[model samples]
Target: MPDSHSLRIVHCFRAPVGGIFRHVRDLIDAQVAAGHKVGIICDASSGGDFEESMLGEMRGKLELGLERIAMQRQIGPGDAVAAIRTYKIIKKSRPDVLHGHGAKGGTYARLFGSLLRASGSRVARFYSPHGGSLHFDLATLQGRFIFCVERLMERMTDRIIFVSKFEQGVYARKVGEPRCGHALIYNGLANREFEPVTPGPDAADFLFIGEMRALKGPDIFIDALTRGSAMSGRALTAVMVGDGIDRNHLIEQAQAGQMSGNIRFLMPMKAREAFRLAKVVVIPSRAEALPYIVLEALAAGRPVIASQIGGIPEILGEASPALVKPEAESLSGGMVTAINDLEGFQQLLPGTQVLRQKFSVENMAMRLEAEYFAALGR
Candidate 1:
C-alpha cells in the first residue's frame, strides 16, 4: 500500500516531444530522486529518433514503467480505443496521483482517474494545459467543443497546474475559471543548463529552433532572415533546427525566398548544442505556454529575440528590446537591430542570478511535490 510519504505518480501526455516532454522528464527525475515511484504514458507515433533515445534513457528510471500507445493529434473514432487501453495500463499501475500534461493526456488522466475513484482508489487527478487546445481560436467550432470538454473535465481534476500566468488567464477566459485547485509554476532549468554555451567560430548570425509548423513561425523566421538581410544591406545566415509536419513546406519556403544559400536546416538536437551553432536565438512562436527553449537559451547565455506572445514577456520582461510582435516585419526588424549591436542586445536580457533563483528545477520539483501532498490532504 502507498503511504503519504511516497506516492505512485503517473504522468500522461500525447506527444513525447518539445516542452511538454522536457517538463515531464524534469518532474520524473526530481520525483524519482525524492523517493516516489514514477511512470509515463505518451504517444507511440509522435516522436523521432531523438525522442526515442530520450525515452530509452528514461525507461530504466521509471518505477511504474513507461507505456506508449498510438495517440492521434486530432479527435477521432480511435480515441475510444486509445482511452480504454490507456485506462487499463493506468489501472495496472495503481497510481496514487494521475498527472496529465497537454490536452489528450489531461482528458485521459482526469476521466480515467475519476473512474478509478469510483472503484475505491484514492487517486488525485492533475492537469496542466501547456497551451495545447487553448491555442485554437475560441470563435471556431473546434475551439468551442474543446473548451466545453475542458470545462467538464475541471470537475474531475483535483488540481490544475498552469506553467504561466498567461496560460492561466487564457484558460479563465476561454474555458471559464477553473473550479478546482490550481497553481502557476514556471518551467525551470537544471543547474548544468545554466552554464553558458559559447558560440562556435563558424556559428551563424541567428538560430530558429522548434517545430516546423506555421504556428511555431518557421516560415516567419525564414521571411525575417530575408528581410533582415535586406535591411542590413547584406545576406544574413541562420540555422533552422527541428523536425515537424511542415518541415518540407518550410524548406520550400526558404528556397522560394532565395534563403536556401544562407539557411541551414538540421534535425532536432540538444538545445545547448544548437545554441552553440548560432550567435542569437529566435523564438517566433505565435502561441506557447512558457516554452522551455526561451529558458534554455537564456540559461545558456544566448541572446534571444522572441515574439511578445504567450508567457514570453513574463520571461524576457515586457520592456526588453528583444520582444517583438509575431510577424515577419517585426521579427526582421528585431533581427536587424541585434545584428547591428549584438552585445548591447545581449545585455538587455534578464540577469543570470534572477533566472537561477526563480527558474531552478530544484525549486520547481519541491513546489510540485508539496502541491501533490496538499491535494492528497497529507
Candidate 2:
C-alpha cells in the first residue's frame, strides 16, 4: 500500500518526556518531511500537561497515527499485559522499522519486532539506550541483572544506536561487545535553535533547568548556589526551572540552607525561554548521555558550567575550563569565576558555527534514515 521509496516507521518509548521525547519529535518531523509514514507508541500515564500539549501538536502529522498505552517505569507483573497490548498496536501499524528509545521501549520493540519476524513479517528492530539502564553500576546486584538482560536482548536487536562514544563504551563494559550492528549518533538541534537569545535586564545570575532529581543533581545546584553566594560575599540570585519527584525536597533543602529568598523555583518551560531568564546556565548533572540542553545553551550563545561526566566532556572539549566535577565545591568555584569574569568565560564556550556544523538536525536525520534503509537491505 505504500510507495517503494517511503518506509513505515514506528517509534516506541516509555516516558514521552525529556531527551528521548525531544529526539523522537525531531526524527518524526524530518521523516514526515521526507515523505515517510511515521507513528509513535509510548506510555500514556507518564507525562504531564506540557507533554500532552506537545503530543497534541504532533497528532495530525503522523500517517500511521499515535498510540499511547499504560506502560510502567519499573519491571513488574503488569508488563506482560502491557507488552501484549503494545504488540497488538505494532501489528496494526504494520511498521517496517520498529525503533525503540530507552530501556523499556527497547525491550518492547526488540521483543515484539522479533515476534513479528517469527510470524513471517519483515521488520527491522533498533534500540537507543538514551542513558537508561546503562547508568546502573556493575558493582550492584541490580546492575548485574540489568546487564544480563541487555546481553540477551542483543539477539533480538538489528541495530543499537548510541548517542555518544561514552555511552557505547559503557555498554561494552557492562553488557559486553554488541553481537549486532551499532552506531554512534549525537543528538542535534534545529536551525531556528541556533539563533542567539538575549538575556533580559532582570535575568538572574545563574539558572538550573532540567528534572530536579539526584541523578540530575538539582541538590548540587542548590548547594553550589549557596556556597557561591557565600564566597562572593553577596547574595547570588538564581532561578531553578523544572519539576520532578525531588522538587519539594530540593526546595526544602534550599530553605534549610537559608537560600529560600534568593532562588526562584518554576515549572518546566521551553529551553530558549528559560535561557533568557539567566545570565549563565548551570548543568551540574551527576550523569548524562550527551544532554540536548548543553547543545541548546551553546547554540543560543549562553555561557554554561557543566559536570565533566558522561559525554559532556566530548561536547565541551576535554580541555574546556567550563568542565567541573559534579561536586558543590567545584561547581561553586566555577560559578564564582563565571560571575566575576562573564565576558571571558562566555568566550571559552564553543562557537555557534562549530556547534551548528557538528550537531545539525538535518544531518542527524539523514544519517539515521540511511541506516534504516541499510538495515532493511534496500
lDDT of 1: 0.93
Candidate 2 residue lDDT tens string, 1-378 = 358869999999999888899999999999999999999999988777878999999999999999999899899998988999999999999999999999999999999999999999999999999999999999999999999999999999999999999999999999999999999988889999999999999999999999878999999999999999999999999999988889999999999999999999998888999999999999999999989999999999999999999999888999999999999999999999999999999998899988888898998999898889999999
RMSD of each: 1.3, 1.2
Error of 2 at 352 (Å): 0.9
In model 1, where do residues sit more than 4 Å from their true spots?
Answer: 1-4
The runs of at least 3 residues in candidate 2 whose Cα sits more than 4 Å from the true structure, single-residue gaps closed, are none
TM-score of each: 0.98, 0.98
Per-candidate local distance difference test: 0.93, 0.94
Q: What TM-score does candidate 1 get on C-alpha atoms?
A: 0.98
lDDT of 1 at 93: 99
